[model samples]
Target: MFELTKLVRPNILSLEPYRCARDDFKVGILLDANENTHGPALSELSETEKILELNRYPDPHQHELKQQIINFRNSKPNKYTETNLEIDNLCLGVGSDESIDMLLRCCCTPGKDKLLVCPPTYGMYGICATINDIEIVKVSLTIPNFQIDIDAILQKVTEDSNIKLLYLTSPGNPTGKLINVDSIVELLKQSYSKWNGLIVIDEAYIDFTAPNGSYSQSMSTLVNQYPNLVVLQTLSKSFGLAGIRLGITYSNKKLSKLLNSMKYPYNISSLTSNVALKATAKEGLAMMQNYVDKIVEQRSIVLKKILDLKYVGKNLGGEDANFILVEILDKNGNPSNEIASKLYNTLAVDNSVVVRFRGNELNCTGGLRISIGTEIENKEMLYKFEKVLNELNA
Candidate 1:
């Protein structure tokens, strides 16, 4: 065991994780997991027939799913090619969240080593780091707009800091602002030369930016050029497979091999693999493309409306992703929390609709992090928002 393992709480390191049937998904009597041998719910019978695969273990290597992803990327005219990197350079995980934990487990020494994060970003990064017993070094993103101050990040990384990882979320969660591609490439180049830390870019929202075609060129080319860079993408967002929980990480072969070796076997369920495999099918891909187009269009309208709103005014930033993050404040300079609470309460009265809130911790407090909903939902939101603003003004 590594030195870090010993430092982790005895309950944590040696603690036998809940051995749900889902946890130990390998060869077994199947009885241990207590899955209903009788079969799935009646409504899901059609899907059960489509998969036709329950008797045997899923492909431990996930060969079909890997090929489909490679094909999907290859079909893109803008994708990068690796002269030496093979499909072996990639590995599938339950979600990017799993890989996040796996990377910390493989690299950071618990209690002694640390990872760097720019917050008001993804909460998952912090959660995974804590569970692994890795100390978090939080360098808050520059205020107003949550763009990273690369200078501050670089300055903080020192010989004594034991910094092994740096996390950047593109079109960052809650903030919905993308860091410039040139800026990110520059950071990767400098960090690798000066420090031994890994630069991980979480591009979960990439598909949302496809129609705009901003980073499409620069991002793909730069990632392969930097050996220390690791890029994570997911099927959950644009692919509309959130329940399936498929995430892809693009990295150099050496790191890929290590991640593959450490991940628990069958971490992805056979059902998930099948759903993901089907998603890359002709009809499924078309559906995803259509959804992305609609989202991009709807996101634009929402941003404009938010900017036009009497209370929010011009403080809202131009969104480059499916969700828009705008600053909402009353004339009193109160944060958006009160207004968002009112909106949430109003929408949820029927118990059929709901809106999400990202508090002040993200620098967008008075702002609501509204996701682009269906056409009806968007219109309803506009009506509700207009009513709320009128009432507040009254």
Candidate 2:
């Protein structure tokens, strides 16, 4: 029998994680964890709230939420195959951040193993690597398209056998490019055969890409085909549940089991689970689709309008996600970080419309990441943006 205990680091094996007082004694004075003895700060409780068993710990496995997620994903038409996922194929985390950290902890030995990433992508992958004391190798996305540099990635992987995980963000953060399924397939094939490292595709913005009923664009449906591939989805974006802090990962049962084993027990609170259940219900899903439709419609209109402005240059990547990555141009028709910074600050500080300034990222100089907003809000944002640009040009 293979014992995972032998593979874990000496420090981690001996380390003790902090436990709450509830872990030991749930009754009596309950002074162990230093929680407030006076009860919650709320002066009143709703009828629904009064029914909650707050004194008891939440389910560590979160079986109810897991089944809901399975049903939701399986409800979509599987473009790759007719297969459906079981609860065993899914794992829940505090957020995608936790899943990222857990993967690093389980796969990468500190100071020895490395992870590969494409920059102008999500910042967390590298941040997590740094926090875990693991090495990060960068292979930047190709400019003009913001697609993965497949050959470059393969070269890096071949040279460094210690690379344990490769992070790829589809409909990439700040880039807004939806990496093609073919490119992902190629990378997965190469990584599995060459390095045997896990390929993690962060699909956080996937819901904004296609229409309500379509699963054609998501890579999650392909998880069964490739065991080495892991796809991450979150309720934060499309479901409008960011405050609930629920993120999900889909992969093979073996990997899912490993991740579950390494995670903290009772990671998901009962309240979060209850709300998430409602959100995944039939009515909630319909409502989410309606919201997605409106956002996508607004995004299209805003993209077209922004392109018409003289100071706005190329849309840096594919407009596949809820956000747009557009270049801020100078009067001479070239990228200008100075103009972008000024526009970002002016819109935020003066007009009270905030957008991200991403000029410092690789190949993203003079870029601003603008998330899709309500129709009226989008119009107002563009009005403020143009106003700021005019002032700068003046």
Candidate 3:
């Protein structure tokens, strides 16, 4: 019999995780785990505060929240009618961060296995690999367009069997481009079968690709067909529920169960589940769509206004995501990391306007990542940006 225990490190195999109080029983006094018996210290309980069962342990499975997510995904319109998913195919995490970490823990043996990632993408993928002591193989994305260097990725994975996971961010961070679905499909068909490794598509900004109830641009529907594929989504971006810290993973039933088994019990708190439930409902979905529409509209306005600035150069990405990555040019019309860093610091420290500086990232030599904000906020950001540029140039 091939046992999974052999894959786990000997130290982890011998270890016993701390058992929380709620692990024993959910009802009848719940004295097993050491919790505040007298209730949390609060002079007055609000409506939501009164409703939450802080005394009891949260549902380890989060069945109700999972159902809401399943329904929400199915509610979206895709080209194929068979895009429906069930609870078996879904799992919740503290955030996509947890899922990413757990996936490495479950599959990659520390110091023995490795993962592949395209550079100038999400930073967490590499950070998590480093934390786990897993080797990371970097294949930089093609410059200018910020698309995957498919040939290089295929070559690396084929040559190295230790590579167990591949992380790709659609609507990539810093670049703000959507990796084309065809390019991904080609990689899956041509390369994934050869290595038998998992491909994780991080769609944190997927909702910005289209309007609500529409997922034509998302690759989530392909999960059902591709056993090796895993799609990660979050309520943080378009849903506007970052505080609740809810992230979702869609994968094959077997892999989903394995991830669940390895994850800590009660990872999702009851308070978070309650808030997410309301947000996934019909009324909440409509409200989220309205906000997305306005953001998209403002994004166009911001893009145009930034391009008109004398110091701003070409926008680096496809502009599919909610943010814009614009190059900062020097007086000589060349990309200037020094000027970009200066402007980023000036805006954040003095003007109270915050944006990311990606001047050091690959292919983004002099880039500033500005997220789409409200109309007034966008105007203010541009004003501060121009002011800082003029001062520096003067």
Clash list (residue pairs), candidate 2: none
Tens digit of per-residue lDDT, candidate 2, span 1-394: 1123443445555555545555576577665655555545567877655555554556677777788778877777446645778888888998899998988897789899998999988999989999999999999888778888889998998888788788999889988888877888888877676766788999998878765355657777667778878899899999999999999988878677777776787788878888898999888999998998998888889999999998899898677788898989988888999999999998999899999999999998899999999988998998889888977877
- Select the stronger candidate by TM-score from 1 and 2: 2
Range of the 10 consecutive residues with the lowest summed lDDT in candidate 3: 1-10
| Residue 85 displacement (Å), model 1 | 5.9
Score candidate 1 by lDDT.
0.70
Best TM-score among the predictions, by candidate number:
3
Residues 155-182 of candidate 3: C-alpha lDDT, one tens digit per residue: 8988987887899999899888988877
User: Which residue pairs in candidate 1 collide?
Assistant: 335-366, 336-366
Q: Sorted on TM-score, highest at the top, how do the candidates line up?
A: 3, 2, 1
Tens-digit lDDT track of model 1 for 1-394: 1123332333344433333444456555566544566654454556565454464445667777777776666555233333433476577888889877877876787887888999878899999998888888888878766677888888887544487788888868877777766677778767766777777888888777644332152243334467777778888888988888988777766566667766666677778888888898788889998998999988888777767777764444336667876666675656567876666566667434566666555466666677899888888887777676657655
Better of 1 and 3 by TM-score: 3
Score each candidate by Cα lDDT.
0.70, 0.82, 0.83
For lDDT, candidate 1 versus 2, the one ahead is: 2
Superposed model 1: Cα runs more than 4 Å off: 1-51, 77-85, 143-145, 159-161, 210-224, 315-318, 331-336, 350-352
